[model samples]
Target: MSRFHLGLIINPLAGLGGPAGFKGSDGVAQQALALGIEPKAAARTRTALECLLPIKQGLHFLTFPGPMGADLLAEMGFAHQVLGQVHEGPSSAADTREAVEALQQAGVALILFAGGDGTARDICSAVREGQPVLGIPAGVKIQSGVYAINPRAAGELTRRLIEGGLVRLASGEVRDIDEAALREGKVTARWYGELTVPEEGGYLQQVKQGGVESEELVLADLAAWLESNWESDVRYVFGPGSTLHGLAENLGLQTTLLGVDVIENGEVIAHDVSEAQLFELVDGHPARLLVTAIGGQGHIIGRGNQQISPRVLRAIGLGNLRVVATKRKLATLEGRPLLVDSGDVQLDDAFPDVVRVWAGYKEELLYPVGK
Candidate 1:
């Protein structure tokens, strides 16, 4: 029997900016590092690769050297060949593109990469139109549809492919946000291109929907309800998204549209805070997490809001979470359960099977939650 040849790429600095409150990890990696932000891309890639260990004997990996791919593979004792060398310093976008080109030439069956949307754009630029690729969700700006819901899901999909299970291919859009605009409190996402990815509706995340919600009255009503229910002693941690931003506007509070903010007693205490800052503020305090699902993705946790880290969630507690989304946005999911990929497997597993979503004025819908 022939071994499955898999190509691997890891963007070592992919997610450093997320927890550091840099919005996106494009050109500010060094600054984030200066702030002592630890990189998690390699760790996340390891989680994905761990799922393939059972079939290690039947697999052969082709990847770039060091932190790009070979380091983690070597640590895991996978049978892999190093394909190229990364530049001496921190790996740049050029390194990712060069690695993709080399992997294409190697005729590998699939290219599994760990990065955010920017890395997806790099892969799209260097590969042939139909070349197969899969993304492990390990980057800050994961607005692209190419990534698996989480690292474990990426490996599960790869395992099925290697075992010759019936899998279908589909085109996923490669989208990215302008980090400059994102930092300026403006979101401008443009479609770069598309990549052929292994399709399993349950495994792959849907493209993030970008636009204004059509149901203006519904949002206003939801915001009103939240305002009426505000507790003076409870700190409100607002997660990012247009839906929550609308809620903030209702309260006449300036908030970061793409970053987490903390409010207490009807005042914005912190704006665009990092995970560490958030943990410090909410720990041992009465806090309610006010978050909304990604429009089309149905992810109430861990899509783009990394500031709401596991410790932050522990501080806020699951019972204090208030999910707000318009019914129209919920319909885009087509009855799929909301997803939570908080990076802590046990924490994600502890989430209840169902959650209550505040849909409108004094209205709540019992929605299902999934890992």
Candidate 2:
């Protein structure tokens, strides 16, 4: 049997703005530096690739030079053909497009890219309609449906696709939120384009659309349930999004619409915290993490809530996590499991098979959770 040709592309600078409280990591290089953000795209892509190592045989990998693609694969001892010119500084969207064209010209069977929605948009621009592509979730604003639940899931899907399992190609939407407006606590998401994503048992993500009228009503009901359940002794770490922000308002507490906030005894303790700050606030306190799903992505972690890092989740424990979302938002997934890419593979696996989502006032729905 012949080998399968797989194209690999990595946006090394993606997700740098996530932990720094930026809404998205687009062109905020200087601000990301000032906020001391570190690149996580390579590490995230490697996580997916690591999952494919066992079945690496009979799979021919094609990648770009240096950090754009080849570096991590070489370090992992994979035999891959590098394409395109080697660049010194930060890789641009042009580099991604060029790599996609090169891989297409070389007749690659599938392409896997690591970045958020912007990167997905780039891929959509370069590849044809039927070209199969998958995304390893790596950026801050992942509103697109092309990304796998996480890196491990990406690897699993890739393995299934290559091993001739029952995987189907579906047109996934590429959506981008206005970073400037997002920073100002307003989400302006628009449909950019579409790309072909691999889907197996409804494992792939769906494009996010913000809450509608029904979801808004459900959020109010969910807030009522949460407000009545609050404990004075437990410190609550609230993650980002309008859902949580609305919940905070229902409790008469102010919250940063795009950053993590902490509340204890009905008082705001910390606002717009970093990962380090989250660790400090949760230390020695009975803490509970209240996070809402990204409207379209169905992600509770590893999208814009990097402030709730894997370490923080481990520290708080999964039992202390309270996920809330409107039933309408959950329905957007069409029965696909909610995803978590906390960047810690083991921690992600520790999540239970199903999580209880507070979808309405005193109403809960058991939803499947995936990594």
Candidate 3:
């Protein structure tokens, strides 16, 4: 009969560094702003909160002041109590910890934060073992497994939590890497502490697995087939990851290992192109998107390669899309469907059935793709 109390926190600068080409959004907010990059945490948080609006009557919100949290809830017509103050400048890690401590002291049932792994680490540092915390992924390079597959999924999980339908609260991984080294093309992710999260089968994300042994032979065979069938005049957009990087290497082309690249006539045309550049490139030319799913996560879009925006996907057309992954990588998914979060809900709903994935030379597997 009592009301459900949910604590909320938002790191306004969580995703500002992503599109600005910074490896992570940690201490690079000012630099990203100087480069004309706007913060996305607020918008992303709104998307999640909007999904929870249907059940607003039964829930009472506890959140931080201003843009840090309460503003979005208030704007959405939800009842909430504001916690500690955040000064006019950027919100620091200390502010997040203070908010968490205050929310815990207020006896909230759960805490929902909008940020990246850094924000997750802050929650882990502040909350006790049984304190429930969930993440609404609003950052670049989401190497951790604590986040939902997308903002909508996060909202769905929260809805179940508030309705008392969420029966499982499992410990999910909290991982992060050195942004400085990651920017230098060196990927070294370290495991941090775990946090209690609401879990729903096939809806929540699984922990991201570490690098697997290279599937060189299968990748080489796939590359050989690609080279032979590649259209002479068509442009191919290669998404990030080692799989696509291997394909680039097979063609003797240099690619930004962790950034999107464009190949045409067996040459690198646009190296590390942005979303706008991708839109321009695919305007008139026959283009195809060659992307691979993230291991364990099974996300073909919206993980690290945000440059391949939904607009870019529409330009290439779904028929022009080609997915490539090793058999070993597919095995890690363990029957979970491949996922997508292109930031367009309509676009995400367009493909609800299975899509063919190129697993090897003349090899194909029909994997389910969903939002």
Best by TM-score: 1
lDDT of 2 by residue, 1-371 (tens): 23557899998878888888777788885588677777889999989999888867756789999988888988988879999885567788899999999998876767899999889989989897666789999999889999999999999988765543435556789999999988898889999888877677432222234424365676677767777888988999999999889888877889999999999888999999999999988877799998888776779989999989887897887878978876666656655567888888888867754455666676644455655
TM-score of each: 0.55, 0.54, 0.54
lDDT of every model, 2 decimals: 0.84, 0.80, 0.81
Question: Per-prediction RMSD in angstroms?
Answer: 21.7, 21.7, 21.5
* Candidate 1: clashing pairs of residues: none
- Candidate 3 per-residue lDDT, tens place, 237-355, comes to 99999999998888778898899999998889999999999899998779999999999988998999999998899888876787888766866776566788888988876652445
Distance (Å) between predicted and true CA of 250, model 3? 61
Model 1 weakest lDDT span, ten residues long: 201-210
Provide the clashing-pair count of each candidate structure: 0, 1, 0
Write down the lDDT that model 2 would get: 0.80
Best-fitting candidate, scored by lDDT: 1
Residue ranges of candidate 1 with Cα displaced over 4 Å: 201-371
Off by over 4 Å in 2: 202-371
Pairs clashing in candidate 2? Answer: 208-296
